[model samples]
Every structure is written in C-alpha cells, then in structure tokens.
Target: MHKNDTLNPELKHAASTESGFTLVELVVALLVISVLAAGAYSRLANTDTQARLASLQSFKATVLSVAAMAKGMCISDPQCDIDQYQTTSSTTIEGKPILFTGRYPVGLAPHGAGGLDQLMMPGKFTIQPALSDTNRATYFLAGAHDERHCKLEYSITSAQSNPSVLSVTVDSSGC
Candidate 1:
C-alpha cells in the first residue's frame, strides 16, 4: 500500500468536507442577535415610563374619587357648606375629620395631619411640599428621572367664585 492510502477513510472525508460556519455566516448571526437585543432593550426602557404614567393616572382617579366622596359627605351634612369656596370646611370620614376647601380636599399641611395625603395615603409616591399655598400639592414617584418634570399636581380652587375646581394634572414627559 502507498503512504497516502494508509490514512483512515473517515479522517480523509472529514478533512475534505471542512463543515463549519464561514466568516460571513458568523457575522450575520451576530448581527441578528445584536438587533434583537437592541429591540428588547428599547422596549424595556419604555416600560418604566409607561409604568409611571399608569401610576399617575391611577392616583388621579383616586384623587377624584376621594374628592367626590368628600363632597358627597359635605352635601349630606346640613352644617357643611359646599358652595363656600373661600372658607375651609370639615367633613368626617372613617371617623376622622377631613378638611376641605369648597368641594375639594386640601393638600398636605406642614405638620402632616390635614390634607389630601391624609385621605389618599402615599403608597409608592413621595408627597412634596404644598406649592404656593395649602391648595396645591405635588407628588413624585419614589425614583424618577426628574421629579419636577415628571409629577402629579393636585390643586383646589379656594378663592375662585365660578365653581369648585379640583385639578389633577400629570406631567410624564420627563418620566
């Protein structure tokens, strides 16, 4: 037998075939994986902002509900006046006296006793100081990109004569 013929048949066949990924194939696979990863990352990044906006919407609903309940209580009580916009009033809820301005609940106070925070407890949010006066309150998420830009503002009309205005505005552009 010759020297070349002495080699194993399987080894010679494998060497001739050379079955493996080429450089182009490997690069394409890597590129696909990177694209998929980038898409997933972008979706994940937006999820946080969506979550914040949903939370703010839920909180706004709660604020509206609380104000409606307070106003209902005020209307039912003969002593309480719902039309008085300039004067602060009180209504008993859950055996606790909640103060109100016209038909809307007031914001947080310095001593942390009487305000909208009392009615709706701050669960995952941080209650900031009352803006301008006790009528306006701002809430921020616990961990946000910019608290000032991404926040929920609750304001009640006190001195206005038109009607009681309980505004709950959410600014989630910076969230």
Candidate 2:
C-alpha cells in the first residue's frame, strides 16, 4: 500500500473530506426541507383562504346586522343617516368606508370579489350592488383566489328563499 509513497497527502485530504455530511445525509436533509416547506405552504394557503372566507361571511353578517339596525332606526335613506355611516369606513374592506355608501341599504348590497393571500397573494375585495330585489338589502361578496392555489368564497341566503343553494362551494386548488 505504501509503494507509491511513504505518506500520502491525498489520502489525508480524502479522510478529512469524509468528516461532514454523507451523501445520504445531504439527500435526507433536502427531502426533509422539501416536505416541511410543502406542508407549511399548504397550511398557510388553507388558513389564509379560510380566514378570507370567514371575513367575507363576517362582512355579510355585519351588513345584515347593520341593515337591521338601520331599519329599527327607521332610516334606510339619506334623511336620517348618522355620522359613522357618513364619514368613517370599514378598515378591513376598503381601508376607509365608502362615504355615504350606506353601511347597508335595501336592494343596496355591495358585490365583492378578490384574492386573499396573506403570505403570497394580493388581498382583494370587490363591492358591488347586490343583484337581488329583496326589501332587505343584500350584499353579494366573492373572495377570488388563484384558481390553482387558493380557496375563498362564502354565500348568504335566507332560509325562506328559493333556489335553496343547489350548490355551495369552497376550494383550495392553489395549494
């Protein structure tokens, strides 16, 4: 074995090279990181989606409640409007409430559609007049997400209404 040399510097270096991570160790590390990242990304996307949906639902409920309050006060028109309804806006929806945008008006529902991704997506909310003619104002809200990456949508309908929700859907394809 010593025929080539009494002492081999190359041999010493090779032995030292063997000190850190083995091939298997490196591969395993990579695999573990990949798995962790995948899991994290998935959770993040789902939670964000759910939160968005919840907010939409909350907004819907808020609209309904505010409408009821407005009704109780016997004021859906601009005549008996107050300060909050005229000046302040909702922080979550539009940064600032749309002024004179009646918090909730009969047949005055706002339509909202957008993508809500806290970590990696643009959070959007669309508010448009509801497409129904119910005396009680209704807001149609839709949280649009990366069709291939997120899931966020919530619908509101009266228990005594028609077309009894033939289908209600929620998805997280983006994940």
Candidate 3:
C-alpha cells in the first residue's frame, strides 16, 4: 500500500465515525430540557395557592380546637369559663398562663399551639362570647400574605341536649 494510504479499514472507519451529537439532536435535547424545566417551574409556582389553602385549613382547625378545649373546660370546671379563654387583642396564645393569645393550643404544648408555626402568613385571632347569649361563643382567625388570604370562623353553642357543639367555616376567597 502507498505510504499516504497507510490506515487500516478498521482505523479509517473509526476515524470517520462521528463523536458528537448532530445539530438536530442537540436542539431536540435542549428543547426537551427546557420543557422539563418549565414544567418543574409551573409545578413549583402552583404550590403557593395550595400552601395558602392549607394554612387556612390549619388555622380553621386551630380555631376549632381552641373552641372545643374551652368548651370542654367551661363545662367541667366552674373556675375556667369560656370567657376566660377569650382573646380580644392581638397576642400569641400562651397556654396555662394566659389561656389563649392570638393563637390556640391543641395539646399540652406550651404557647402558640395548634400549628401556629405553620401559619407563615400574617393574620389575626379573636375569641368572644356572643353578644346575644352567654352560652355561645365565637372565634375568628384570619391570615393574609399578598393576594393570598384566609379566614376561619368557629362558633360553639352550649345546649341542654348536646352540651357543646362546634360549628366551623373556612373562607379562602383571597387564596
């Protein structure tokens, strides 16, 4: 064989084989990656609404628990009345010492219980006996962060038949 044509068939074939992706392949790969990235971003972006709704639900549960606990205590202990647990101001609920502040406790956990930490949004809480009747009470908790907002209303009535019945409503119009 001539000196210039020294390469074996296997060597020539290996040399001629392409080592990199074609332009179309690279473009398709990039497009796929971008689509995946956009999907991930969309999924992540939708979480805010879900989170706001969850916060509302959690706040509603907290309010309900507070009402239930107060009702149970009022029913059992003559000294601890439902009115004592009422919070008319802006303050965090501190268990035992002050009964309830802006928040309510679920268990024996100290201060700001009922998943208050989960309320990453700004909000308010209030508890008061119905002006019309002393045997009934109302609890209100609301949160708003930007366009996301939630409110929870809880009412407890003491009746001769049921003793205590809790009614709860959750509003997520802003969320």
Candidate 4:
C-alpha cells in the first residue's frame, strides 16, 4: 500500500519490467522502414528510364540486322540492288512481309507474324536512300513508350566483292 507498491504482484512486476518496445527501439525501427521506403521509391522512378534505354538498344539491333541482310544479298550478286527493296515507312515494310529471300527479321511482339508494330515500343522503321554516290542507305527506327522516345539511325554502304560498311547512331529523350 506504499506509494510505489501495489497489492497486485503482476502489475508491480510489469511496471518495473517495462513491456513492449523502448523509445530507442521504436526510433530504430522507423529509421529502417524509412530507408527501405526511399530505396523503393528511387527504383520506381528509374523504371521508365530503364525501359527507354532497352528500347534504344533493341532498335539498334534490329536496324543492324536488316542492314546485314541487305549486305548479304548484295554480296551474293554484284548486281543486287538494295534500292529496289528500300521503303520509306514501317507500314510498307510490314506490308512486304518478305525481304531479300526470307521473312522479315524484325517481328512484332505478341503477334509473331506481324512486323515492327509488335515491337516493344511499337515504333516506325524506314530504309531510305542517302544522297551519296556510293550505294548507301539509312535505316531510321523510332519508338515511343510512356515518357520516352527512342530513335536509331543506321547506314549501310555497298561495295562489290567487299564487306558492306555500317554506321549507327542513337537518341533517346523525354516525350
């Protein structure tokens, strides 16, 4: 019955023992949670950026593949004219279905038989003659997804009995 003593032994024991978490423990837990939350937020913010970069990389690869195929065809026959197969739009490329002597190298996603429209970013690709005395053409591939737009430009030059020359450039920006 003293000021510090109670009739119930359990209550007295608990008061002296201190139950649940201490102030320092609570603060540490909160700090750990805040750190994890911040990491997750940063990763989410970078998701768009990662997608944009991947699109650019894929676009470049597709363009290069097409160019290589064209070069191979030209090599087989010195008279092979790539200009005959050149297209100004991806739609035309899609419509053609076949280039050189095989199916189109680029396939649209989900729709295996379709063209670049099935691509990850769903963009346009064009093969146009670049103004040059050499048999050189430029491949322009562009795609837009979310807040990013990626463009890849690749050029191929033909030379009889010689390896075809290739050049590529890429650009990706916010939409």
Candidate 5:
C-alpha cells in the first residue's frame, strides 16, 4: 500500500460517522420549550385575574347584603339608620379596622349574609371613620390576604342621595 493511503478501513469509517444532535433538531426542541413556557405563563396570569374578579364579586355581594340588613333594622326608614359606622371583623386595614355594619348577621334563617358578619381575612381589613358627615357616611375598608400578595380594599360609600357605592380593588402583594 502507498504510504499516503495507509489509513485502516475501520478508522476511515469512524471518521465518516457523525455524532451529536443536529442544529435543526436542537432549534426545534428550543422552540417547543419556549412555546410551552409561554403557555404556562399565560395560564398563570389568567388564573390570577379570575381569582381577583371572583373575590371582587364576593365583596359586592357582601356589601349588598349588609345594606339589606341595615335596611331591615330601620324598616320604617333605612336612610337615617345606616349612619352608624360599626367595625366588626377579624382584621384591620390601613390601621383602621374591619367592622360589620349590618343587622342580624343575616335576615332570618340562612344564618349570615356571607356565613360571617364580616368578609375579611384576619389582619387584613379596615373601616374608615366618618367625621364630617354628608348624605350618609363612607368607610374605606382595606386589607391583605397575604403579604406582597393580595391586597384589597372596599370603598363603602353609603349615601342617602345616591345608592350605596361598593367597590373592591385588588393588587398583587401575595401569591
């Protein structure tokens, strides 16, 4: 054999054989991973938003029920009776306090409007005081379900001129 062609057949075969993942295959895998990650992120964000909305709806219901309870207490005239600001709850917000300004806890039997006199998490709620006075009285109830997680507040505006304003707002401070 000529010196220039001295390589063994097995050695030549080995050199010709390729090894490792293809660039195309690696790119495809990366794309799939990215897509899956994006999908997971999107799902998480949507779930968070839904949870917030549900909590808000619950708060709205609580406000309405409380209003009804107050109305019942003053069957003759609810306008003048809902003036008292009562704080009854298991928490506090903005250093104020959480309170239940309703009557009977519930109307008749079902027990309570929300199974509880107040709809608040412990250490998370407040009722703003009314000093000046206006059409009725307003209270700002705020609290957090978790630190750096779910901080929420209710703008409870009770007025004789306009229907009571009950609003709930939430911010992510907890998970």
Candidate 6:
C-alpha cells in the first residue's frame, strides 16, 4: 500500500488502463471480418457469370442485326436467288462475299464464301465450327471452362421465313 501510494496518480491510471484488445476480442473481430470477406467474395464470383450472360446477349443481338442486313442485301440484289433452297447463292456486301441459302446467310463458309464470320466484327470471344453440327457456328466466351455448354450457337433455319436461329446456352459451372 505504501509503494502504491508513492506512485504518481497519472502513472497509476496509465498502468491500469489496457492499450490493446484481449485474445477473445481479437478472435471475434477476426471471425466477423472473415464472414464479411466470404460474403463479398461470393457476391463477386456471381458477377462473372452475369457478365458472360450479358456478353452472350449482346453478341446475339449483333448477330441478328447482321443477319437481317445481309438478308436485306440479298433480297435487293438481283443476282441472289432467294427461291432456290437446293442451290446456294451469294452476294457481296462491304466487299465481303456473303453466302446464302434461301434468302438467309449461312452460319459457316459455303464453297469458300464467307458466312457469319465475315459479317460479325472481331470480339472477345473465340469462334469455332460447332462439333456436333456443321451448319452451326459456336461462339465461346474467352477463358470459359465448358466451351460447348457456355456458348452461342448461330444456325441457318431450313424455313425461309425464319431464316436463322440464334441459340444461347450458359452453364454456371462453366463460367
């Protein structure tokens, strides 16, 4: 008691007050931070799938627009034979020869003439001929896991009225 009384009041107060957190408090804080980080990471992970889906939608729109324009050009040109489905026809647009079958642009090259590839602008996707079907052009998202599942398939429809079909398939696991 005498030694304690000899010490200054300010020094005694400073010694009694703790400067840092206890082990239990530190552990709880770490746990909360970890939980928040986990939640944030999960949310961020979903954004990639969303981004790929959006890209696919945009690409599909571009493909539809290009197909329509090519069809219009085919209809306007006297050389394009829209009535003949058995025989392939072609017309030049912007200096590129676009191959067509019954008023619709073919999905792939036909007899060395350009199809969908010539119409579409270069994008961030990888374009390849679909393995399952020769008539389809499959566009895969760059860095995607399952190329077949996560892709946009552009194919020429048999019916002249429909002309073409754009199919989008996105597998979340692939993204």
Best by lDDT: 1
> Model 1 has how many clashing residue pairs?
0
lDDT of 1 at 46: 89
Cα lDDT of model 6 by residue, 17-112, tens digit: 958999999999999999999999999998877887787778777887887888789889989865644346889989988887666677778556
Error of 4 at 70 (Å): 2.0
Better of 1 and 4 by TM-score: 1
Q: For model 4, which pairs clash?
A: 108-118, 109-118
Question: Over the full model, what C-alpha lDDT does candidate 6 score relative to the true structure?
Answer: 0.73
- Residue ranges of candidate 2 with Cα displaced over 4 Å: 1-18, 75-105, 108-130, 134-138, 142-175
Model 3 compared with the native: what TM-score?
0.53
Q: Compare candidates 2 and 3 on lDDT and give the better one.
A: 3
Better of 2 and 5 by lDDT: 5
Query: For each candidate, how many residue pairs have backbone atoms clashing (under 3 Å)?
Result: 0, 13, 2, 2, 11, 0
Between candidates 1 and 2, the TM-score winner: 1
Instruction: Point out where model 6 deviates above 4 Å.
Output: 1-8, 16-18, 84-87, 130-135, 159-173
Quote model 6's TM-score. Answer: 0.75
Residue-wise lDDT of candidate 2 within 15-39, one digit each (tens)? 7677687899999999999999999
TM-score versus the correct structure, for each prediction:
0.80, 0.43, 0.53, 0.53, 0.41, 0.75
- Candidate 5 lands at a TM-score of 0.41
For each candidate in the order shown, give its overall lDDT on alpha carbons. 0.76, 0.39, 0.47, 0.46, 0.43, 0.73
Order of candidates by lDDT, top first? 1, 6, 3, 4, 5, 2
Sorting all predicted structures by TM-score, with the top scorer first, yields 1, 6, 3, 4, 2, 5
**Candidate number achieving the greatest TM-score relative to the actual structure:** 1
Give residue 131's error in model 4 in angstroms. 12
Candidate 1, run of 10 with poorest lDDT: 107-116
- Summarize candidate 4's per-residue lDDT along 1-175 as a digit string, tens digits: 5976645888888778886998999999999999999999999998867866776677678666665653454435433433323321122232443222121222221223323332223355444333211223233444344222345544443344543445666766641
Alpha-carbon error at 7 in model 6, in Å? 6.0
Point out the worst 10-residue segment of candidate 6 by lDDT.
Answer: 163-172
Worst 10 residues of 3 by lDDT: 100-109
Ranked by lDDT, the better of candidates 1 and 5 is: 1
RMSD of candidate 6 to true structure, Å: 3.6
